[model samples]
Target: MRIGTMLGDVLRSLFSRTATRQYPVERAQPPTQLRGKLYYDPEQCTGCSLCVEDCPAYAIELITIDKTKKQFALRYHVDRCTFCGQCVESCRFKCIQLASNEWELASLDKAAFTNLYQRAENDASNVEKVAATDVETPDKE
Candidate 1:
Protein backbone atom coordinates (compact mmCIF):
# COMPACT_ATOMS: atom_id res chain seq x y z
CA MET A 1 0.00 0.00 0.00
CA ARG A 2 3.09 2.33 0.17
CA ILE A 3 3.29 5.09 -2.52
CA GLY A 4 6.83 4.09 -3.57
CA THR A 5 5.94 0.38 -3.90
CA MET A 6 2.81 1.21 -5.99
CA LEU A 7 4.83 3.57 -8.23
CA GLY A 8 7.52 0.92 -8.80
CA ASP A 9 4.94 -1.73 -9.64
CA VAL A 10 3.18 0.56 -12.16
CA LEU A 11 6.51 1.41 -13.86
CA ARG A 12 7.48 -2.29 -14.11
CA SER A 13 4.11 -3.21 -15.66
CA LEU A 14 4.33 -0.34 -18.20
CA PHE A 15 7.78 -1.49 -19.46
CA SER A 16 7.06 -5.27 -19.54
CA ARG A 17 6.08 -7.18 -22.75
CA THR A 18 2.40 -8.07 -23.32
CA ALA A 19 1.41 -11.49 -22.03
CA THR A 20 -1.28 -12.20 -24.67
CA ARG A 21 -0.86 -12.71 -28.40
CA GLN A 22 -2.78 -10.71 -31.07
CA TYR A 23 -5.50 -13.24 -32.01
CA PRO A 24 -7.14 -12.29 -35.35
CA VAL A 25 -3.99 -10.70 -36.79
CA GLU A 26 -1.47 -13.37 -35.71
CA ARG A 27 -3.32 -16.70 -35.82
CA ALA A 28 -1.75 -19.83 -34.39
CA GLN A 29 -2.20 -23.30 -35.93
CA PRO A 30 -5.03 -25.35 -34.45
CA PRO A 31 -4.31 -28.68 -32.80
CA THR A 32 -4.53 -31.93 -34.83
CA GLN A 33 -7.45 -33.32 -32.80
CA LEU A 34 -9.34 -30.05 -32.41
CA ARG A 35 -13.12 -30.51 -32.59
CA GLY A 36 -14.34 -27.78 -34.88
CA LYS A 37 -17.23 -27.84 -37.35
CA LEU A 38 -19.17 -31.02 -38.07
CA TYR A 39 -18.93 -32.60 -41.54
CA TYR A 40 -20.93 -35.38 -43.18
CA ASP A 41 -20.34 -37.58 -46.26
CA PRO A 42 -23.68 -39.04 -47.43
CA GLU A 43 -22.11 -41.45 -49.93
CA GLN A 44 -20.76 -43.74 -47.24
CA CYS A 45 -23.66 -43.23 -44.83
CA THR A 46 -26.16 -46.13 -44.56
CA GLY A 47 -29.05 -43.93 -43.37
CA CYS A 48 -28.25 -44.96 -39.82
CA SER A 49 -29.51 -42.55 -37.16
CA LEU A 50 -26.84 -43.55 -34.65
CA CYS A 51 -25.29 -40.09 -34.78
CA VAL A 52 -28.68 -38.50 -34.11
CA GLU A 53 -29.38 -40.86 -31.22
CA ASP A 54 -25.98 -40.28 -29.59
CA CYS A 55 -25.92 -36.49 -29.84
CA PRO A 56 -26.45 -35.06 -26.35
CA ALA A 57 -27.31 -31.64 -27.76
CA TYR A 58 -29.69 -32.90 -30.50
CA ALA A 59 -27.69 -31.09 -33.16
CA ILE A 60 -27.84 -33.67 -35.97
CA GLU A 61 -30.82 -34.95 -37.99
CA LEU A 62 -30.67 -37.65 -40.67
CA ILE A 63 -33.35 -37.44 -43.36
CA THR A 64 -34.09 -40.31 -45.69
CA ILE A 65 -34.36 -39.13 -49.27
CA ASP A 66 -34.70 -42.55 -50.91
CA LYS A 67 -34.78 -45.79 -49.01
CA THR A 68 -34.09 -48.02 -52.02
CA LYS A 69 -31.25 -45.87 -53.37
CA LYS A 70 -29.82 -45.19 -49.92
CA GLN A 71 -29.92 -41.44 -50.60
CA PHE A 72 -29.93 -39.27 -47.48
CA ALA A 73 -29.42 -35.74 -46.26
CA LEU A 74 -28.04 -34.56 -42.92
CA ARG A 75 -29.25 -31.42 -41.19
CA TYR A 76 -26.69 -30.07 -38.73
CA HIS A 77 -27.63 -27.32 -36.28
CA VAL A 78 -24.26 -25.75 -35.47
CA ASP A 79 -25.60 -23.43 -32.80
CA ARG A 80 -27.09 -26.37 -30.91
CA CYS A 81 -23.93 -28.44 -31.28
CA THR A 82 -21.58 -28.61 -28.31
CA PHE A 83 -18.62 -29.78 -30.48
CA CYS A 84 -18.36 -32.85 -28.26
CA GLY A 85 -17.46 -35.27 -31.13
CA GLN A 86 -20.15 -37.74 -30.01
CA CYS A 87 -21.62 -37.94 -33.54
CA VAL A 88 -18.21 -38.77 -34.98
CA GLU A 89 -17.75 -41.57 -32.47
CA SER A 90 -21.25 -43.04 -33.04
CA CYS A 91 -21.05 -43.14 -36.85
CA ARG A 92 -20.00 -46.66 -37.86
CA PHE A 93 -19.38 -45.75 -41.55
CA LYS A 94 -16.94 -42.94 -40.74
CA CYS A 95 -19.18 -40.51 -42.64
CA ILE A 96 -18.96 -37.86 -39.95
CA GLN A 97 -16.00 -35.85 -38.60
CA LEU A 98 -15.11 -32.53 -37.05
CA ALA A 99 -12.87 -30.38 -39.26
CA SER A 100 -9.87 -29.22 -37.23
CA ASN A 101 -9.12 -26.21 -39.47
CA GLU A 102 -12.72 -24.96 -39.64
CA TRP A 103 -13.12 -23.74 -36.05
CA GLU A 104 -14.21 -20.22 -37.08
CA LEU A 105 -17.97 -20.80 -37.37
CA ALA A 106 -19.23 -17.44 -36.06
CA SER A 107 -22.04 -15.79 -38.03
CA LEU A 108 -24.55 -12.97 -37.68
CA ASP A 109 -27.23 -14.71 -39.76
CA LYS A 110 -29.49 -17.23 -37.98
CA ALA A 111 -29.85 -19.33 -41.17
CA ALA A 112 -26.13 -19.99 -41.27
CA PHE A 113 -26.39 -22.16 -38.15
CA THR A 114 -28.35 -24.83 -40.01
CA ASN A 115 -26.37 -26.83 -42.59
CA LEU A 116 -27.74 -29.40 -45.06
CA TYR A 117 -25.42 -31.99 -46.61
CA GLN A 118 -26.82 -33.96 -49.55
CA ARG A 119 -25.65 -35.53 -52.80
CA ALA A 120 -25.42 -33.47 -56.02
CA GLU A 121 -27.74 -35.84 -57.82
CA ASN A 122 -30.58 -35.43 -55.30
CA ASP A 123 -33.46 -33.08 -56.09
CA ALA A 124 -32.39 -29.69 -54.81
CA SER A 125 -35.91 -28.23 -54.74
CA ASN A 126 -37.32 -31.08 -52.68
CA VAL A 127 -34.39 -31.07 -50.28
CA GLU A 128 -34.59 -27.29 -49.91
CA LYS A 129 -38.30 -27.54 -49.11
CA VAL A 130 -37.65 -30.25 -46.53
CA ALA A 131 -34.75 -28.37 -44.96
CA ALA A 132 -36.65 -25.10 -44.78
CA THR A 133 -39.74 -26.70 -43.32
CA ASP A 134 -37.98 -28.94 -40.82
CA VAL A 135 -35.35 -26.52 -39.48
CA GLU A 136 -36.37 -25.36 -35.99
CA THR A 137 -36.14 -21.61 -35.37
CA PRO A 138 -35.39 -20.23 -31.94
CA ASP A 139 -38.36 -18.77 -30.09
CA LYS A 140 -38.80 -15.00 -30.33
CA GLU A 141 -37.83 -12.91 -27.33
Candidate 2:
Protein backbone atom coordinates (compact mmCIF):
# COMPACT_ATOMS: atom_id res chain seq x y z
CA MET A 1 0.00 0.00 0.00
CA ARG A 2 2.91 2.39 0.81
CA ILE A 3 4.54 1.69 -2.54
CA GLY A 4 1.24 2.38 -4.35
CA THR A 5 0.82 5.72 -2.50
CA MET A 6 4.45 6.72 -3.28
CA LEU A 7 4.00 5.87 -6.95
CA GLY A 8 0.75 7.90 -7.13
CA ASP A 9 2.42 10.91 -5.46
CA VAL A 10 5.37 10.79 -7.85
CA LEU A 11 3.03 10.72 -10.83
CA ARG A 12 1.08 13.73 -9.48
CA SER A 13 4.31 15.63 -8.83
CA LEU A 14 5.42 15.11 -12.45
CA PHE A 15 2.36 17.15 -13.67
CA SER A 16 2.42 19.85 -10.95
CA ARG A 17 3.66 23.36 -11.47
CA THR A 18 6.98 24.49 -9.95
CA ALA A 19 6.49 26.04 -6.51
CA THR A 20 9.66 28.16 -6.46
CA ARG A 21 10.35 31.59 -7.84
CA GLN A 22 12.86 31.92 -10.67
CA TYR A 23 14.71 34.74 -8.97
CA PRO A 24 17.56 35.23 -11.39
CA VAL A 25 15.46 35.12 -14.55
CA GLU A 26 12.23 36.64 -13.27
CA ARG A 27 11.90 39.10 -10.42
CA ALA A 28 9.10 38.91 -7.88
CA GLN A 29 6.75 41.86 -7.63
CA PRO A 30 6.73 43.44 -4.21
CA PRO A 31 3.46 44.76 -2.81
CA THR A 32 2.29 48.25 -3.82
CA GLN A 33 2.60 49.55 -0.25
CA LEU A 34 5.82 47.72 0.63
CA ARG A 35 8.32 49.90 2.41
CA GLY A 36 11.67 49.12 0.84
CA LYS A 37 14.86 51.17 0.71
CA LEU A 38 14.97 54.58 2.34
CA TYR A 39 15.58 57.52 0.00
CA TYR A 40 17.10 60.62 1.58
CA ASP A 41 17.02 63.98 -0.18
CA PRO A 42 19.64 66.11 1.51
CA GLU A 43 18.35 69.37 0.13
CA GLN A 44 15.04 68.78 1.86
CA CYS A 45 16.68 67.56 5.08
CA THR A 46 16.64 69.77 8.20
CA GLY A 47 19.17 67.71 10.18
CA CYS A 48 16.68 67.62 13.03
CA SER A 49 17.67 63.98 13.78
CA LEU A 50 14.04 62.92 13.96
CA CYS A 51 14.63 60.00 11.62
CA VAL A 52 17.73 59.01 13.56
CA GLU A 53 15.84 59.12 16.81
CA ASP A 54 12.80 57.16 15.59
CA CYS A 55 14.60 54.34 13.81
CA PRO A 56 14.11 51.15 15.83
CA ALA A 57 17.10 49.38 14.29
CA TYR A 58 19.44 52.34 14.89
CA ALA A 59 20.34 52.23 11.21
CA ILE A 60 20.58 55.93 10.39
CA GLU A 61 23.85 57.73 11.20
CA LEU A 62 23.62 61.49 10.80
CA ILE A 63 26.67 63.73 10.81
CA THR A 64 25.64 67.29 11.48
CA ILE A 65 27.75 69.81 9.65
CA ASP A 66 26.04 73.01 10.78
CA LYS A 67 23.06 72.93 13.07
CA THR A 68 22.08 76.47 12.25
CA LYS A 69 22.41 75.87 8.51
CA LYS A 70 20.75 72.41 8.77
CA GLN A 71 23.56 70.75 6.84
CA PHE A 72 23.66 67.01 7.34
CA ALA A 73 25.28 63.95 5.81
CA LEU A 74 23.24 60.77 6.23
CA ARG A 75 24.91 57.39 6.34
CA TYR A 76 22.32 54.68 5.70
CA HIS A 77 23.27 51.21 6.92
CA VAL A 78 21.09 48.96 4.77
CA ASP A 79 22.25 45.77 6.46
CA ARG A 80 20.86 46.89 9.81
CA CYS A 81 17.74 48.61 8.44
CA THR A 82 14.46 46.90 9.29
CA PHE A 83 12.38 48.73 6.62
CA CYS A 84 9.88 49.66 9.30
CA GLY A 85 9.23 53.14 7.76
CA GLN A 86 9.41 54.73 11.22
CA CYS A 87 12.17 57.07 10.07
CA VAL A 88 10.14 58.21 7.10
CA GLU A 89 7.08 58.93 9.20
CA SER A 90 9.03 60.86 11.85
CA CYS A 91 10.86 63.10 9.37
CA ARG A 92 9.19 66.52 9.54
CA PHE A 93 11.21 67.96 6.66
CA LYS A 94 9.93 65.31 4.19
CA CYS A 95 13.52 64.42 3.33
CA ILE A 96 13.30 60.69 3.95
CA GLN A 97 11.16 58.42 1.75
CA LEU A 98 10.80 54.71 1.46
CA ALA A 99 11.10 53.80 -2.22
CA SER A 100 8.79 50.83 -2.48
CA ASN A 101 10.10 49.86 -5.91
CA GLU A 102 13.74 49.49 -4.89
CA TRP A 103 13.81 46.06 -3.27
CA GLU A 104 16.53 44.27 -5.25
CA LEU A 105 19.35 45.09 -2.84
CA ALA A 106 20.99 41.71 -2.35
CA SER A 107 24.77 41.55 -1.94
CA LEU A 108 27.53 39.23 -0.75
CA ASP A 109 29.50 41.75 1.33
CA LYS A 110 28.06 43.79 4.20
CA ALA A 111 30.15 46.82 3.21
CA ALA A 112 28.30 47.18 -0.11
CA PHE A 113 25.09 47.96 1.77
CA THR A 114 26.49 51.06 3.49
CA ASN A 115 25.20 53.72 1.14
CA LEU A 116 26.03 57.43 1.50
CA TYR A 117 23.21 59.82 0.58
CA GLN A 118 23.60 63.57 0.39
CA ARG A 119 22.75 66.50 -1.84
CA ALA A 120 24.89 67.25 -4.87
CA GLU A 121 25.89 70.63 -3.41
CA ASN A 122 27.39 69.12 -0.24
CA ASP A 123 28.89 65.98 -1.77
CA ALA A 124 32.14 67.31 -3.18
CA SER A 125 33.36 69.26 -0.13
CA ASN A 126 32.31 66.57 2.32
CA VAL A 127 33.97 63.86 0.23
CA GLU A 128 37.22 65.80 0.24
CA LYS A 129 37.15 66.40 3.99
CA VAL A 130 36.34 62.77 4.76
CA ALA A 131 39.12 61.59 2.46
CA ALA A 132 41.61 63.97 4.05
CA THR A 133 40.78 62.70 7.55
CA ASP A 134 40.88 59.06 6.41
CA VAL A 135 44.41 59.41 5.00
CA GLU A 136 45.83 61.28 8.01
CA THR A 137 46.97 58.16 9.94
CA PRO A 138 50.71 57.50 9.55
CA ASP A 139 51.78 54.29 7.88
CA LYS A 140 53.40 51.57 10.02
CA GLU A 141 55.85 50.69 7.21
Candidate 3:
Protein backbone atom coordinates (compact mmCIF):
# COMPACT_ATOMS: atom_id res chain seq x y z
CA MET A 1 0.00 0.00 0.00
CA ARG A 2 1.71 3.18 -1.27
CA ILE A 3 1.24 6.43 0.80
CA GLY A 4 -0.09 8.36 -2.24
CA THR A 5 -2.64 5.57 -3.06
CA MET A 6 -3.70 5.32 0.65
CA LEU A 7 -4.23 9.12 0.83
CA GLY A 8 -6.29 9.05 -2.39
CA ASP A 9 -8.46 6.19 -1.04
CA VAL A 10 -9.02 8.01 2.26
CA LEU A 11 -10.07 11.19 0.42
CA ARG A 12 -12.50 9.20 -1.80
CA SER A 13 -14.04 7.46 1.24
CA LEU A 14 -14.58 10.80 3.03
CA PHE A 15 -16.44 12.27 0.02
CA SER A 16 -18.68 9.16 -0.54
CA ARG A 17 -22.34 9.18 0.59
CA THR A 18 -23.62 6.99 3.44
CA ALA A 19 -25.25 3.70 2.31
CA THR A 20 -27.62 3.47 5.33
CA ARG A 21 -31.09 4.95 5.19
CA GLN A 22 -32.40 7.36 7.85
CA TYR A 23 -34.99 4.86 9.19
CA PRO A 24 -36.95 7.13 11.54
CA VAL A 25 -36.98 10.09 9.10
CA GLU A 26 -37.67 8.10 5.93
CA ARG A 27 -38.91 4.53 6.55
CA ALA A 28 -38.30 1.97 3.83
CA GLN A 29 -41.43 0.57 2.24
CA PRO A 30 -41.99 -3.17 2.57
CA PRO A 31 -42.33 -5.24 -0.59
CA THR A 32 -45.82 -6.08 -1.84
CA GLN A 33 -45.43 -9.79 -0.97
CA LEU A 34 -43.56 -9.25 2.29
CA ARG A 35 -44.56 -11.55 5.18
CA GLY A 36 -45.23 -9.34 8.19
CA LYS A 37 -47.24 -9.76 11.38
CA LEU A 38 -49.84 -12.51 11.67
CA TYR A 39 -53.46 -11.36 11.96
CA TYR A 40 -56.29 -13.64 13.10
CA ASP A 41 -59.94 -12.81 12.36
CA PRO A 42 -62.12 -14.75 14.79
CA GLU A 43 -65.31 -13.59 13.10
CA GLN A 44 -64.23 -15.18 9.85
CA CYS A 45 -62.54 -18.19 11.45
CA THR A 46 -64.62 -21.32 12.26
CA GLY A 47 -62.26 -22.64 14.96
CA CYS A 48 -60.55 -24.95 12.55
CA SER A 49 -57.14 -26.02 13.90
CA LEU A 50 -55.58 -26.19 10.42
CA CYS A 51 -53.59 -23.02 10.99
CA VAL A 52 -52.24 -24.34 14.29
CA GLU A 53 -51.33 -27.69 12.76
CA ASP A 54 -49.52 -26.09 9.82
CA CYS A 55 -47.49 -23.60 11.84
CA PRO A 56 -43.87 -24.77 11.69
CA ALA A 57 -42.77 -22.64 14.63
CA TYR A 58 -45.70 -23.55 16.94
CA ALA A 59 -46.54 -19.87 17.33
CA ILE A 60 -50.33 -20.21 16.96
CA GLU A 61 -52.74 -21.80 19.46
CA LEU A 62 -56.55 -22.07 19.37
CA ILE A 63 -58.45 -22.31 22.65
CA THR A 64 -62.12 -23.21 22.64
CA ILE A 65 -64.04 -20.64 24.59
CA ASP A 66 -67.58 -21.95 24.01
CA LYS A 67 -68.05 -25.63 23.29
CA THR A 68 -71.73 -25.28 22.37
CA LYS A 69 -71.28 -22.23 20.14
CA LYS A 70 -67.93 -23.41 18.76
CA GLN A 71 -66.30 -20.11 19.73
CA PHE A 72 -62.49 -20.09 19.85
CA ALA A 73 -59.72 -17.80 21.03
CA LEU A 74 -56.58 -17.49 18.96
CA ARG A 75 -53.25 -16.96 20.69
CA TYR A 76 -50.40 -15.73 18.51
CA HIS A 77 -46.89 -15.27 19.89
CA VAL A 78 -44.77 -13.09 17.58
CA ASP A 79 -41.55 -14.04 19.38
CA ARG A 80 -42.01 -17.71 18.40
CA CYS A 81 -43.29 -16.83 14.91
CA THR A 82 -40.99 -17.08 11.91
CA PHE A 83 -43.25 -15.17 9.46
CA CYS A 84 -43.20 -18.20 7.16
CA GLY A 85 -46.82 -17.70 5.97
CA GLN A 86 -47.58 -21.41 6.38
CA CYS A 87 -50.42 -20.77 8.82
CA VAL A 88 -51.86 -18.18 6.44
CA GLU A 89 -51.81 -20.67 3.57
CA SER A 90 -53.33 -23.46 5.64
CA CYS A 91 -56.30 -21.40 6.79
CA ARG A 92 -59.36 -22.44 4.78
CA PHE A 93 -61.58 -19.51 5.84
CA LYS A 94 -58.92 -16.89 4.93
CA CYS A 95 -59.07 -15.64 8.51
CA ILE A 96 -55.29 -15.89 8.95
CA GLN A 97 -53.08 -13.44 7.05
CA LEU A 98 -49.87 -11.45 7.35
CA ALA A 99 -50.54 -7.76 7.92
CA SER A 100 -49.51 -5.68 4.91
CA ASN A 101 -46.89 -2.88 4.94
CA GLU A 102 -46.06 -3.53 8.62
CA TRP A 103 -42.44 -4.56 9.22
CA GLU A 104 -41.54 -2.75 12.44
CA LEU A 105 -42.41 -5.20 15.24
CA ALA A 106 -39.78 -4.42 17.89
CA SER A 107 -40.74 -4.72 21.57
CA LEU A 108 -38.90 -4.16 24.86
CA ASP A 109 -40.75 -7.06 26.55
CA LYS A 110 -41.46 -10.50 25.07
CA ALA A 111 -44.90 -10.52 26.77
CA ALA A 112 -45.99 -7.58 24.62
CA PHE A 113 -45.63 -9.64 21.47
CA THR A 114 -48.16 -12.28 22.50
CA ASN A 115 -51.48 -11.25 20.92
CA LEU A 116 -54.67 -12.91 22.20
CA TYR A 117 -57.61 -12.37 19.87
CA GLN A 118 -61.09 -13.18 21.19
CA ARG A 119 -62.54 -13.30 24.71
CA ALA A 120 -62.33 -16.44 26.78
CA GLU A 121 -65.50 -18.10 28.13
CA ASN A 122 -64.58 -17.26 31.73
CA ASP A 123 -63.68 -13.70 30.75
CA ALA A 124 -67.01 -13.09 29.03
CA SER A 125 -68.97 -14.56 31.96
CA ASN A 126 -66.99 -12.46 34.46
CA VAL A 127 -67.63 -9.27 32.46
CA GLU A 128 -71.36 -9.98 32.21
CA LYS A 129 -71.59 -10.76 35.95
CA VAL A 130 -69.82 -7.51 36.80
CA ALA A 131 -72.17 -5.51 34.58
CA ALA A 132 -75.22 -7.20 36.12
CA THR A 133 -73.99 -6.43 39.63
CA ASP A 134 -73.32 -2.80 38.69
CA VAL A 135 -76.82 -2.43 37.26
CA GLU A 136 -78.50 -4.07 40.30
CA THR A 137 -76.66 -1.96 42.93
CA PRO A 138 -79.13 -0.52 45.54
CA ASP A 139 -79.16 3.25 46.07
CA LYS A 140 -77.82 4.44 49.48
CA GLU A 141 -80.39 6.81 50.96
Assess each prediction's global lDDT (C-alpha) against the native. 0.86, 0.76, 0.74
Cα lDDT for residue 131, model 2? 41
Best by TM-score: 1
Instruction: Select the stronger candidate by lDDT from 1 and 3.
Output: 1
Worst 10 residues of 3 by lDDT: 131-140
The candidates, ranked best first by lDDT, are 1, 2, 3
Per-residue alpha-carbon lDDT of candidate 3 for residues 1-141, written as tens digits (9 for 90 to 100): 999999999999899997788978978777889998888877777766888777777787776655477566677889888999998888889988898687689989877798776643347554344434432221224
Q: Write the per-residue lDDT of candidate 1 for residues 14-114, one digit (tens) a residue.
A: 99997787999978899989999999999999976788878888798877777699888998999999999988998999999999999999999999998
- 100, model 3: CA deviation in Å? 3.4
Candidate with more favorable, higher TM-score: 2 or 3: 2
- Candidate of highest lDDT: 1
Q: Among all windows of ten consecutive residues in candidate 2, which has the lowest summed lDDT? A: 131-140
Model 1 spans > 4 angstroms off:
130-141
What C-alpha RMSD separates each model from the true structure? 4.4, 6.6, 11.1
Q: Give TM-scores for every candidate, taking all chains together and pairing residue i with residue i.
A: 0.84, 0.78, 0.75
At residue 123, give the lDDT of candidate 1: 81
- On lDDT, who's better, 1 or 2? 1
Which pairs of residues collide in candidate 1? none
